[model samples]
Target: MPVDRKSLFKRVPSGIPGFDDLIEGGFPENTTVLVAGGTGTGKTTFAAQFIYRGAELYDDPGVFVTLEERAKDIRREVKSFGWDFKKYEDEGKIVIIDGVSSSVGLPSEEKFALEDKFNVDNFLRYVYRVVKSINAKRLVIDSIPSLAFRLAEERQIREVLLKLNTILLEMGVTTVLTTEAPAPQEGRISRYGIEEYIARGVVLLDLQERNIELKRYLLIRKMRETKHSMRKYPFEITSDGIVVYPSGEIY
Candidate 1:
């Protein structure tokens, strides 16, 4: 049973308004993408919208691994956009794995003791079980930097991410992993310098001041095996979810 090259290149739509047009249909199927941004940049919302839309419109089952927020809190937040995550869960179309609760015993106040308790293998196994249970095709890790913060050394962070990427590919799921980015810095896609390289695609969300108004923009930094737009497009968060303006000027 060999996998078809056409199936390998299949695109999975993010379902965010005006977003798909920039990436030539959508993201390549089963590819791991890193969504990096600073605080208040709508990184979590983008991931949630992608998952919710996939379940609601595309009929694709999705799994959302929440590293920071509680599963209930995430569901409540998406409710504002008329996305009933709970309903999807009840229907077995979506699953939310609570990474925060599972890692609660790990030392948070002391940075030095994090690595002692952080078990990457255990975490991956937990995620694997959840993904398999749901038969998910789409996956989202709310934020990868939060998970990386638990590691004591930079090498460990890189190794964990590389391993995570391999695991996701083996499962054949399209994944969106979020990471925190330094404030508009030069050449920094994520808090850890290696995240962008580990993932097959990198999409950046940013906020900038324009005439005293804060404007949000989305940029496709890199997408392997596909032609994509290189422009920084303006976007907005509305009641419906994230909406990209691909043709609109950033300045």
Candidate 2:
């Protein structure tokens, strides 16, 4: 069997509003994008909305690999936005892998083994099979930091991520990875060094409390082969989902 590397490069339509407009036209044909942010910064909402938009608007089935939450809980939480996860699941459009189960279900006797505990290789293989089966073009890993922490060494983590990104990109699926910032400080967002460099694009989400106003901003730090808006654009998490304002104001 041979992999047609060229077959994986096809334009993917992003369902998010202002976010896509900032980066020319969504992500590249086949690229891995990192969306790193802290808690309460709307990372899951953004990723969910993106995948929902893909299924409902673009007719592309997407896979969401969540490492922290349950699939049912995620559906319930996002229901206020009118994203019917059950409907999508029934229609065979959206699929969620319960990484929480993998992470927590380590042996009672054995403390931990990165692979024994959270085998991302199995996860990737499953995603690859599903993508090929359904011809899926969009994929997301809710958070990669969890996987990184489980790995004992930095080199091993980087090696695994590098290989995963290469294979996923080679498969021609436009992917997004969600990562939590270590702390609310400069250069504290992404710890794994090669994430930003290796990934085709990077989007940073920041939320800060100033006096009494809680402001949220989205910055397109890097996007290889594309001209992107470099401003820290204001955004909000609404009942309808994430909305990035035209001007730097919370609308």
Candidate 3:
């Protein structure tokens, strides 16, 4: 069947206090964006807020695929910000997958066999089922790097993610997959070259320390086929949630 042209440019609000304005609205339809940051940089929080906002403001059902943390732990962590994940669950607007599974090592008596290969295949399966069931329009996969590392080989990781993005885009869902960026002084960009290259857009969150004060900056590195805010904008994670400072304050 031919694709529908009406699916294009149907903007969905990001739900972050200050982010939408920076992007001149929100992400384009059916595009996968990479949100990369380090520890304590609010990557998980940002993703949750994005999903939460989608469910509440836009009535768009969403799905969260967690690789490292349990579903309950994620709920508790985000509750501090007053986001009621339980309520969203009750309304059937959100679904959380606990991707943590056990693995066993092979003994000398037995040839090597993966008892539970919790690779991207399993992740993709769960995502496919959840999205199809809910007819979800927005998705978030927190910490794609951890999942890639568990694959234990660069080629395997790249291939899995490349295919994963292709599948998600075909579903016409705007998605964000989180990754950890390399240190700035190294003069390198994201560690996963292929993933970064394949994604339709990339938004980088940077935490900089000056004297005793810590500041946060968000930079849109790339947004193919769309206009994006080029400057490094200031953002904060507070009791309410993430708020992107205006262009004047960012400078």
- Those runs of model 2 whose alpha carbons end farther than 4 Å from true positions after fitting are 1-11, 106-117, 152-155, 183-189, 249-251
Q: Candidate 2 at residue 83, lDDT?
A: 90
What TM-score would candidate 3 get against the native?
A: 0.87
Q: Whose TM-score is higher: candidate 1's or candidate 3's? A: 1
Question: How accurate locally, in lDDT, is each candidate?
Answer: 0.84, 0.74, 0.77
Model 1, residue 28: distance off in Å is: 0.3
Model 1 residue pairs with clashes:
none
Q: Where does the lowest 10-residue lDDT sum fall in candidate 3?
A: 106-115
- Candidate 3 structure quality by residue, lDDT tens digits, 1-251: 87553354666678998787766578877888888887778788889998998998899899887766767788899999999988987888888765544333322121111225556666577678778888999998877776776686855877888789889977878998888888877655576766687788888898887567888888889877666768888888899888888654643
RMSD in angstroms between candidate 1 and the native structure over all alpha carbons: 5.3
- Residue range 91-184, candidate 1, lDDT tens digits: 9989887666446764333211212355789778778877888899999998887787656765688889889989999999999999998766
- Pull out the clashing pairs in model 3: none
Q: lDDT by residue for model 2 over 126-207, one digit each (tens)?
A: 6687677667778888878776765666458788887888888777878888886666445554767567766788888998
Query: Which ten-residue region of model 1 has the weakest summed lDDT?
Result: 107-116
Ordered from best to worst TM-score, the candidate numbers read 1, 3, 2
Residue 47 of candidate 1: its Cα lDDT?
98
**Position 16, candidate 1: lDDT:** 95
TM-score of each: 0.89, 0.85, 0.87
